[model samples]
Target chain A: MMMQRRLTTLFALALLSFVAVASSPPSSRVVADSVYAIPMLTLRDQQGQLFDFASLRGKPRLVGMFYGSCQMACPLEIEYLKHLQRVVAAGSGKSISVLLVSFDPARDDLAMLRKVAGEHHVWPPAFRLARTERGDEGMLAGVLGIAYRQLPGGGFSHNVRVSLLDAQGRIVAATDASGRPAPAFLRSVDEALKNP
Target chain B: MISRQLALIPMLMLPFAGKAADYVPIPAGQFESALAIAGHAAKLRLAAFSMRSEPVTNAEFLVFVRQHPEWQRGQVPSLLAGANYLRQWQRPLEPGESVLPDQPVTQVSWFAARAYCGSEQARLPNWYEWEYVGAADATRADARRDPVRNQDLLSAIEGTSGHLPGVIGTRPANVYGVRDLNRLLWEWTGDYAAMFPNPDARVPGSVANLALCSGSALAFADKNQYALMMRVAALSALRPADTAPRVGFRCVREPKRK
Candidate 1:
């Protein structure tokens, strides 16, 4: 009788565990379902390190796209992002990660990426300069709402837009990252960090 | 009995052989594009590539959805497609009686179209490539100079509304032997986002501010090409996840080396 009772208890515990596992959402599903989440892509950073994009899921980030050869807007974009990071850190006491991906993968090789990173003084783990191995860079651009076209003179005409993603990779704020950081966007970042 | 079974083998293999999509080679060339950069007409130097002879059909998309159920109507993530995506289909896996097999598939999002192209070992053509091929007519490779031809294209676009898309290849092929570049659905390009004239500039005084210093805005070299202008306007208005009743796509690939 005791053996049968113990068997019944074991079965109930197994069923409870199965339900728990089934009910909770998987980490991949959470990332895949978010509208602002970057797709499962493997990219190489300026340091020639291969990292899955999803690895940045657990931190709030400011993401944008630019090319290394961009003479004017790209350099300013990096400066603006750095400025925003400083402001967010100073105001909220939280450091936001920055990721600037390259749309011109063919021209922006590792050396070029490294050169730009060094010029901008962007260090990894806080700021990352990266490019994809293939043509999916356009898809990333589309999701971030950045527009770019290659010009006849081998330059690019691209809009500058920056997006802020929460720890789970959900877009909390986005704005034109052309000049000084918009105060409204900074407030959104502050709110995002405060809640967590 | 064994000889009779052997005779049926060729018949069984026929459908599979016919399932492959046909691609035509577009020769490499320096072509002038309608969209301008830095206030001048952009000249594109294209490499040799092969393009699908026709837009993807409803039947073909059905096969893709079956193999990739994640792309099916209800199954697809909202990030990849809006609520209206494939809403006209009878079911997730079936195009149904209302949707014909040969009709060019519409109501597909850009992400979905890109995935379909990827599955075929191809990718969506960039806007420049699409515009380059679109400049052709049945006779001349570059026919944008002909006002009558341009007028006909405008009429075709005006007439396509409130109507289901006709079958692909029903129209005459372009000079490059590709069909349905016009007079059909508005197709998605790989670089649709890149074609925006000045999306950021629309932010009201933002352009005059620091944002405008980036030189991101584009200008049209030939504003007289109303047809191309209208297409660019329509495509620019869409987000990657948004789907339309008339928007569809075809794939392109680099020509195979001998």
Candidate 2:
């Protein structure tokens, strides 16, 4: 019996070692379809017009998820993601947009999403504040792997992760915005795009 | 002299021993197990790993309670204890009885994940390192047919609402060669919940005022539940502790020298 448990431990250790080696950065190839972008409903833009991911299917997005009321990391994360956009445009000479999704659906209405955009000096088509529906907020929580519970007055506990998707609407990568190195990730994506 | 040359040949072979490097860069969901297929990640200098996975399960967590029992946040760690380790696990039946052994463990506290990892001669994967690991692209899942892709079922069941945990393993491994890195549950890392420099989400300003005011921050960082947003918020705090229900872990190591 002792030997058997030892074997199990050995097995687990071996598996972990093999896994550790097998896991590494992906090589340039057909970018996988990981990030799923099928929007539950058409989100409204700053002007309250329907924003369709399908319409922009061909281009990739540097998507950001945050609430308008957040005064801490969310604002900073949003700024960082936008900085990637700026850096991407400046370096690659190509246009990429950031989509800021709010965790606080109750607070972030169409008007609120737009107000935050304006306050931050974001330009046209640079970013979109996705309006939340009754249950849609939970839907997003699932899609993005971000979880938050509503606090007493109206706060939430959430993480900062920004996703990158290829033109085919698959999840390419979801970068952690907590201590995110946005430009490095973008540079890798830029490299992936350049390949082939 | 011929025999002496033969002995030298064996010495040369000894230096080139062990498993051949299997680092292949492919999209997610293509490899059989993301964890299984990923090669050694970028050298883990200064990066630490959680001793274990997320939400250490009931059966596993119960064992923890048996040892320390003080982690219940002033409540009895064993109060809800059934057959599981910690009393924290609530669904899919208890451990050794459920089908979630491979699922990302949940319901852990930083304290718990930390303790477990240390005992095993491992540590929590650092935040950036974990991100780089989870970021292993999975869009090319079918070709690899990895167990990590098993998470697809949960997402499909959730109906694109992105609310439920995806089933484990049906996709390829990321470049890190990690399996099931994404779909099991939000994992715990050594990073804290608060932003940089401070690294203490448990502190007042670490998490936003919303979670800070209600004392939910404690529960938020409970290490169980793997509550996506809360866990993400805790990324900045990085408090450390022992294991819990719904929490399990994988270990990382540097590539061995030839």
Candidate 3:
């Protein structure tokens, strides 16, 4: 029985090493300070494909949170991001990616994500609207300095603080996405994209 | 071999893992929060939920870190917790001699607090839920109106000032059978930051107002509820990743679907 157990343990070790070898190495070890060091947060985008938040580590991205049913501020947020994208592309000839995760996961399902994306004329890959498929959405919100509270009537009271992450997922700059992107914020985005 | 040892951690933690019934049910009710926006006191409705009777103790959190190593002091990313995260503990896994096992754990960030609660299949109580529970004294629910009781609470908070909080359950549970709701430590409500104390948030078209859609500026319903107001102000001043020497948290669970 002892010998049988030994063989089983040996088999497990071999399998573990094999699996480790099969997985792709991170571009670089995620530093303890980086937000990407957050446990693997799997997000389902508007296209309904599951992608890990860590996958965006090697590039600069604009990250924020919004709810699908938000009548005013959320739509304005999308527009502002699009405007930022256009301005950045026009000036720097580089397109920065965007990720907007939902605050209301119960209501912001696959259909809601898709519907919101369609209405804003935003699409995935370059721009994505997503819901947390697994992991703590509040942790992400907290990291990004976003605060939200659900009101009595099912509406959310939230802030539109969008953060600009460097290639390492360190927040380099942030701005209230309620209006046109601040010039200082635009400068940081330009700077991050250049370094990336 | 390492994996085998790690797998035994659950069994090791069995002794420290308190009963699941540690959570006491808080009945549903409506109450006017001290802080409402635009001088309007919005009567908020709360759903019946279960809450941890006592604040999480240091010994219990030590076991939690042993199981989820990523949440340990040095292992936690800076984005999720401040540099002062778990500073009182001698080591990542040891609360040490200076810290008592049953003493409430403090120096925790909101993110860390949320993650700790999440491990128990629970979440941090919302501000309203917290306030609702905090309203109780030994005999009566909604004891905020009693001048003597409020003075006693204020004294208790001031007494613990400049020192670590004492062990949980030193006093009897309130009417809801929950101990140390707002007495020992300033607990992290899930939506602590959602309370906008800034007057600018009330302005209809201001940048702050725009950022906070459907948001109203918070106003205090009663100036006499100084203790609760102090907590709101202190909590609002902290960033999510920021940790404090006096801040700790407890968990709450929604009722099971029939």
Question: On a 0 to 100 scale, what is the lDDT of residue B89 in model 1?
Answer: 91
Give the residue spans of candidate 3 off by over 4 A: A1-26, B1-21, B197-218
Candidate 3 lDDT by residue in tens digits, B230-258: 67776776888888878889999997767
Q: How would you encode candidate 1's per-residue C-alpha lDDT over B37-142 as one tens digit per residue?
A: 6577877798889999888888888889888887889888777888989887998986787887777898999989998998899999988888889899999989
Name the top DockQ candidate: 1
- Please provide, for model 2 over B136-211, each residue's C-alpha lDDT reduced to its tens digit, 9 standing for 90 to 100: 4545423222444334433532343322243344565544445655544556654333222222222333334422
Give me the runs in candidate 2 sitting further than 4 Å from their true place: A1-34, A37-39, A53-55, A133-135, A178-183, A192-196, B1-258
Candidate 1 iRMSD, 1 decimal: 3.9
* Backbone clashes under 3 angstroms, per model: 0, 135, 3
In model 1, the number of clashes is 0
Model 1 residue runs over 4 Å out of place are A1-23, A26-28, A31-39, B1-18, B199-218
User: What order do you get sorting by lDDT, best first?
Assistant: 3, 1, 2
Cα lDDT, model 3, residue A93: 95
Model 3: lDDT equals 0.82
> What are the Cα lDDT values of the candidates?
0.80, 0.47, 0.82
Fnat scores for every prediction = 0.42, 0.00, 0.54
Judge candidate 3 at residue A27 and give its lDDT. Answer: 49
Tens-digit lDDT track of model 2 for A163-191: 77666445566676544455568776676
**Location of the lowest summed lDDT over 10 successive residues in candidate 2 chain A:** A28-37
